[model samples]
Target chain A: MENPYIVEPAAITSIRQETDETKTYTLKFVERERTLQFTPGQFNMISLLGVGEGAFSITSSPLQKDDFEHTIRLVGNLTRAIDRLAQGDIVGVRGPYGTGWPIDSAKGKDIFIIAGGVGLAPLRGLINLIIERRNDFGVVEIMYGSRKPDELVFTSEYDKWRAAPNISLFLTVDEVPEGFEWTHGRGVVTNLLGLSKIDPANALAFVCGPEIMMRFVARSLTIRGLAEENIFVSLERRMECGMAKCGRCMLGRAYICTDGPVFSYPEVRSLPQNLLAASF
Target chain B: MVKSTPRALKLENLNILIDAVSQKYRTYGPVAKDGENAWEEVKADGELSLGCAATMLPAKHILQPVRLDLYSFKSSGGFQIEEPGFDEKIALFGVSPCDVNAILALDRVFGGRFVDPYYWQRRENALIVASNCTESAEESFCTSWDTGPELYSDYDLLITELADGYLLEVGSQRGKVVVNGLNLPGATQEDLKEKASRLDAARAATKKRLPVPPDDLHQLFEERYDHPIWVPNAEVCFSCGNCTFSCPTCFCFDIRDEVKPSRKEGVRNLEWDSCQLLEFAEVAHHANFRRLRIDRFKHRTIHKLSWMKQQYGLTGCVGCGRCVRWCPSWPVRRGRITSLADPVEIIADMLEPPEKVEGVERPGGVIV
Candidate 1:
């Protein structure tokens, strides 16, 4: 019997500091025979053995089979333990669990990707897939934001993504540092939605960030003539067993672990308001 | 597979059946536990109490234990994972009809899209021996849910009490194995007629009525999602989690890893969890989804009565009434305490329109 509880050990080959509070670990499955084929938006339950486990979105695309990456923010006990690990350290890995982004369904449509802070991690895979099949999609637009210019992740990859044909990239910071020589707009990411030139009716928008940010961006897109069904948002909930069995991640009827991490605005509109509230 | 002809066992031969079943498997039945009846391991015939009104805890603990080791890991040269093994062949004796239904509901949850291998392993190795309820217990509403007094299916063996002796019906091949050497006589048409009347009397004895029919809950609850009843009712709730702990079909759990003092090895455990707890939906960053007590209170009932059916095609509650009996905060009305967790009262109140306050002006300063 395949015990779903078992975590396969993966060796971290390298680590890159994305920000002061977050790092991206590049790992390869210890057993070379194993394949980590994960779709965009699907998350892996990464475990730092003897410490704890957490569910993180698989940032590296399935297009690269040999090595996968998880961009982790230093938040809780498990993530903090993960951040302390050096290169060549082995961490237990399980999953590629939960439903992924509707890549196949959104094909041939203009794709609008909106992300904030480290929330861009999950959408990174989807963006890569879209760029790989560049011709398959219409004009692709990505608007990413961070608290400050220094907090942004994947800074080096921004230029490469912008260089792609028919793709426009926009970056924003909530508060620009005084000493930083930043040239981009400074405000909440939703402020960029009005400047984005994509026709909302023709585009499928994917938004992941703070719940408040996602709500505002979703509202902006809807106001810009995007259907509620066309706008997607990723929900962040407390999950123990990434499987729905652990009810900690319940969003009314839906278990955020299995039913979503990704849900359309219309799908979540019926859910209780407290799930997406900025604070109690 | 129900019996074409039920079997009969003399009153004195009850021990013979217990001995026959326990010879091959560990038998468990309702037994005295700290002044209350509970499911416990029974070795002797005298330890079995088949007629106990209701066990404090449902027999679900046999399959889904309170603290289950999901998996354990060791750090030798590299990491090796070990899954917990379950191979105990056990037979649960004297299970109530509602509890049996609860097991069936749990089967749908753990057996849905991703089959819970651990739960199924225990379920596969276990046998069920159901005992009929001759009279409905206080606070029980099994009759309202079609889950008490008699069971239609899913039992290995069902024992129906009669005036003289017990009518034993074999519902599966495993049941046949249990009764093979007992030399019990085949039940006659007269015994079947007597059994039907007894079940009918027991069903009539149950007075509790569900506020809404199971079929109409989906539509009714969808309309009452924002009903005002949720606020004041939940305000008095202690959020103690007694309702969930005592619930038969509540399968919410929390996963955690516990390491040894040496910090070399650890086991990931899935502990039974309750949605009523404030931290149930709290994330690491301190953002709680169901932070308000009212939301948690509403979540428990909605998940059980409405959402579980939509998700798994089976109701999460089996009308066992354990939550009602075990709740510490249930208010007494006319010297009779009614469960606040009762779907009957909760839904009835939600269906009614909110009381109109006369003197207070509306938020916009508009008064009706």
Candidate 2:
């Protein structure tokens, strides 16, 4: 009986400026008791009244029931319209859709979470879940990088993540800007894989970022003696309808919206592998 | 439940059946207009263009219109959507066997995962009267895919043109209602034997075929992603998207928001879009996934021949040959002036050994 296209109204409660181009908006359903239940990597379709609709990752931790969060960048019409709105402004929200990260499969394994720029936003919920249940998992290592020092999101939570037992955080910037300050590793996120102490015997890697970045990370993990089946990557596509019917987010047989926003390296390899193509 | 017996109706009593169906639903049938067959509303006394396979378009336009409004919205207050009404109940009379196969493929696309109420509203409620293809067209290759010249499922009524008269096969209980009302004579064993011979001749008439077996097609596309044949084949592609528009199985669509002059209200519509267009895969900042002519060109051919089978159980192309007949651009092939607008031409080239020519490699799954 449910129409997937119909959206429930959610009011933006607060907005945090993550960078010059990105902002994190916290929202709650206007109906008070209505809340969207979701896992770490799943996303929601947000809309601006008459403008348009766009998909955003549910960046909030799964435990947070009263509200949800989405870190959006100034990419297109809907995001631009969303950035201009003040707190308490109501917008249409229609998901928490997609197969999220396989949280149960990685329960007893070492977790290696890698991200780039705003790509870290989608993984933030998974990171929070691991930190909260640190005893349920093994060693945790977080590697993230951005083109510039100012582009890194969730900087405030880095120290807290580092303070957690058995969790190591490695931050990097493609290049530190002039007059701006940065003290972590420099160059692409791939440069820090040499220092990672993750043992391939019992490890699960969750990666997300621009399509190009995930490709490099998957290759780096494979080169480090990790099985293709063990590495999980989040793919990006031009999704209009979160449902599989849109055909926009298709990668071979997989409809990125329904089949995955998340897929194993081996599963992705089995597809035609055009869009995430490797140089022959 | 008693099985309905097949009935034989003389050529003169054809209108009696149409009039019977019209009592329950608004009926539409093929009509000859300017030497081309077009689907038009058939009144009780209207002349039906039976025994024709020259319709310019398929039944897709009937179920999902070229521009169907999903809903209307107002920008003044909170975000809201008002779904359009689902009122009209339309039925098809004398639909081709190839198109019936096309409707089944579309039924899976819209009926799976999230059922599209808009498409099902028309497809489920309306009755279907399918007619087998007795004569093959110039471009039709439906026999290669086993989707034409005969139909086995998804029709309420099946009509086959016999040498002397018409033989009606009631495929469903609904189809029997009309035949029983007319009280037509039961078809003789000789008439049934004539139907089999007619379809066999129709199949033999189709000269074109896909060469490659259906099971091995997926592997072919995988190994030849960067085949050198795509370059020169794409050289004269105008990207006009005529092939996709005329295709019976090309179901890709793009959503558009038509804002009013005052900017206070708008209507959201989903229009059939072709991958051949540059903007079909455009994302933010004008970053296109299939920017090049070859990428868009190869995607359409490969998706239909291979990827569609992987996505859905059936191949997206029913070999209706609409793409071949509708293509506007005529690129040359071999030594003579030939049409390279057909999917068969490109897919055939990919199936063969690659020629040693300088060709650009196709881009990987790149993000915007």
Candidate 3:
């Protein structure tokens, strides 16, 4: 068998700018093959022929297989190249790598989602997935925060999320702009956690955001009576190879690429290496 | 066991053997420098430096190149993923037994679990010719680790300098193939016995030892998880990752894709990576795990001594002392062994923990 580094062609069908710096690209199988099968939270290694390759989480749920979505922010070289791509442009994609959110275990349980900035991309997949099977889950709440109102992503779908009876959507921003009409909470995303009426004793929380933001959010949840193990946070590491071989993404013996991009707060806390405050 | 007599070969005859091997293999051997020795690829027997103690770098470069192109791709949606192709065999000559054992240890790692095909390809087609050490260097501690100046099954042949020429012992089929073709004198029983005695004396002469016993290494590290020793000792770590790069047993790497300027062609490359690097554990949202220099330093030691043992049934460190010698930091100096704490005390604490320790509580809510 060939090594997993093999690249296959993927065609971009549409592009939607989520924010000034972040965009969501929709890709379809150019060969007309069956839709790509991947769970929410899993990512793909996207290659722009002469530019470079980067790992981006699938922003679309597994339930939607006809097409897939990748939410990318203009951060470095490869991402900048991807940001320049237009509809019908061809790029190389490998994998639906890494483990996804555990939905089966979330059945009949209340789902609490907390996101910050572009961290919402992966959580958006889970939200859409849960919404599709709305009756299968109990009270669903989403608390999302951005640096500013203009930075909020998926603005087109906010209205639909607000109208859903089974879900409660709470949005927050760090600061309000002059002459801007804002009705939602205006503090950190963790501040919106107080507006939801779910019982922490029976709810599972999934959080993704800036490291500092996630730390505070986790602390808030713990103080609110949520178990440390009940809170899962997605970690972003400098992953060159999304395989276990590369020691780049290692936290002790566990490789983030193979073991997890998602880990419980207690698990992360136990690793002495995981709690270090400086850049790795 | 079928014991073969040791035979002698002149330096000239040895050169011919190397030349013949180089015809079909990439030959690597020791090269003498300004009163020192280093291992490198040699094209002829004249380049062999049998008198050298050890190579500056371990032989890992043969199996795991510093930089390797994993795959290449072109525009028009066409690409090619590179596969492991060991077209040329390898002949490693004048390797110390310690270095040979280091490769064997690496074999247990890269050859199992994920089974690195690239390493395996090179390994399958390679031959190891180890040299029996006549003297030990000041920093050498292979004897303490049970890896020594003598030979093992991992080598294809074992060579020792004799009174007039060199003693050659065929260690494998490949060694026998080379020995049968060499125009040299056959050996007698006395020559075999004398060679054995010389090897035994070399083993006995080794004086260096690791401060900590290998058996107690795991528990020692576990107990020292919060010990102050790591903090003070690791303060000097520069995090340059030179220690890992020069280590024979360290096989960590990073995979990346590089594209041509025209955006039409690209290649996936695998480069040597080290956990000592600051970004080794930084995640997507810029959360760096193992951020502190102390944490990174502790990780390298813990992984080599504890984590690798648990995962692979063998310690990751091969007692090569490269990390100790290569680290630029003062406190990070190599070969300074520290004794392990008692295992019984550690186990007792775990079993007899305080009933009311602060900040220790079970969760009362659902776990994700």
Candidate 4:
């Protein structure tokens, strides 16, 4: 019998602090010969063994062999416990699950990548893929924002991403503290959209953020002339069994664990309740 | 395999037949407990509640234990999954057809996409001795769904209560093995006819009914998705989760890791969970998707009636009436009747919204 819940032990190779509350972990299966095969935008169920499991996106480039990264924000019991760990700590890994971003659908199209806070972590995989095969897609624009400038993640990788041909980066923050040197848009992420030059008719836009933020991003893109089907957003819910049997991740007919963590704007709108708001 | 003739055993000799069956399997049956029956291990010497009414919990507990450890991780061993193979060959006696239907519903859920090997392991090992209802319990509405009074199929041994003897219809080869060489008299054609008429009488005795056919429930629910009765119902609902706990087909679960004091290792366990609880749908950052009492309440009924069909091509509720019996809310007034968390009443209210009608006095609580 194949036990889906059994976690494979993986040794943490490295950890990098992204913000006061968030860190990126790089891990590889301890068996050494086994490889973590995953496409861009899919997620892995990271287990601290004693603490519990959490579903986080594979935040590294899929083109990279052996290892994958997860950018985790210290939120609940499991993640905070994850923060206490150091390099060489052994953790459990179970996935590479769910539908990934529609890379094939986005091929030969202008691309727009939108992120807010740690939401950028999920898109990082696709961003790396785009950089590696820069000629496969049209003009690529990345718009990312954090509440504060210091909260931005992967700051070291910004220069390398900007160096990719036909790829542009638009960074923003909600606010900045006193005596901080901030040279970026100073508002919500949507404000940075004004700097984008991609034609909506020829582009596919992917958005991820706080639910409210993703809701607004989808609306703004629609107003900017992108068809509802062409705009995709990733959603999160309380998930236990990523197999979709747990029933925790349900949103209307969609089990956020199975049918999507990623859904096009039209599909989101077709669901019964508003995932983006407090109302029905 | 040849179709075996139905057999007959005198009611007094039931214990003898059970003794014959016990040699090859672990027998489970309902036993009297505090005025109600409960599914329990039936020792060869112990009594069986053969003609008893509904049990508090269904036979699902036997197949899927309330708290089964999925796996354990040790500092020394690294990782180990709890046994995924069930070794016991068990036989369940007098399992109601509604409960059998519920088990089948669960099979669809666990069998989808990635099959649940743990559940399938135990479920596949067990043999069912299904029994037809001779009488209806207070909360039963099984006839409306055609899920009780009798089962057409899906059991190993089908037992029917007759006046002077037990009419045993062997449905599978395993059931044939249990009754081999018992020398019980073969059932006459007239005896099978008697069982059919008795089953029909049992069906007629279950007075409660749904407003629409079971096939149309999903569509009807979809049309009445935002029916006004929900808010008032939520106000009365205690959210105590009694309904879900007693429910036959409520398979939602929560997984927890229990680590030892040494912090060296732990075990991950899967246990029954209810959507009625406020925290069932809460994700990170204290954001609960189904935050409102009304949201949770609607989710329970809608998921059972509508969403289950969408996901698994079956009704989540098997018309067992467990939720109706266990819901804590009082006087859930629907069209022409009152019952808490009753699927029939809920659908009846959708057919005729009680609040819309004038001068309808609610039984205990107000909906108008």
The RMSD of every model to the true structure, in order and in angstroms, is 3.4, 2.9, 7.1, 3.5
Q: Would candidate 4 be rated incorrect, acceptable, medium or high by CAPRI criteria?
A: medium
Error of 2 at A22 (Å): 1.0
lDDT at residue B103 of model 2 (Cα atoms): 85
**Residue-level error in angstroms, candidate 1, position B105:** 1.1
Give the local distance difference test score of model 2: 0.80
Question: Which residue window of length 10 is worst by lDDT in model 1 chain A?
Answer: A271-280
The reply for model 4, stretches above 4 Å from the true place, is A277-279, B1-12, B50-53, B76-85, B332-337, B353-368
Give the interface RMSD values of the models in order.
Answer: 1.6, 1.9, 3.1, 1.9
Computed on alpha carbons, the lDDT of every model, listed in order, comes to 0.81, 0.80, 0.72, 0.81
State the C-alpha RMSD over the true interface residues for candidate 2, after superposing those residues. 1.9
What is the per-candidate TM-score for chain B?
A: 0.91, 0.91, 0.81, 0.90
DockQ of 1: 0.66
Error of 1 at B215 (Å): 1.7
Ranking by DockQ: 1, 4, 2, 3
**Between candidates 1 and 2, the DockQ winner:** 1
Candidate number with greatest TM-score: 1
DockQ, every prediction: 0.66, 0.58, 0.31, 0.58
- Candidate 1 Cα misplacement greater than 4 A, ranges: A273-280, B1-13, B51-53, B332-337, B356-368
Structure candidate 1, residue pairs in collision: none
Residue B103 deviation, candidate 4, in Å?
0.5
Cα shift from native, residue A202, model 2 (Å): 1.6
Error of 4 at B138 (Å): 3.4
Residue A255's C-alpha lDDT in candidate 2?
A: 82
Error of 2 at B191 (Å): 2.2
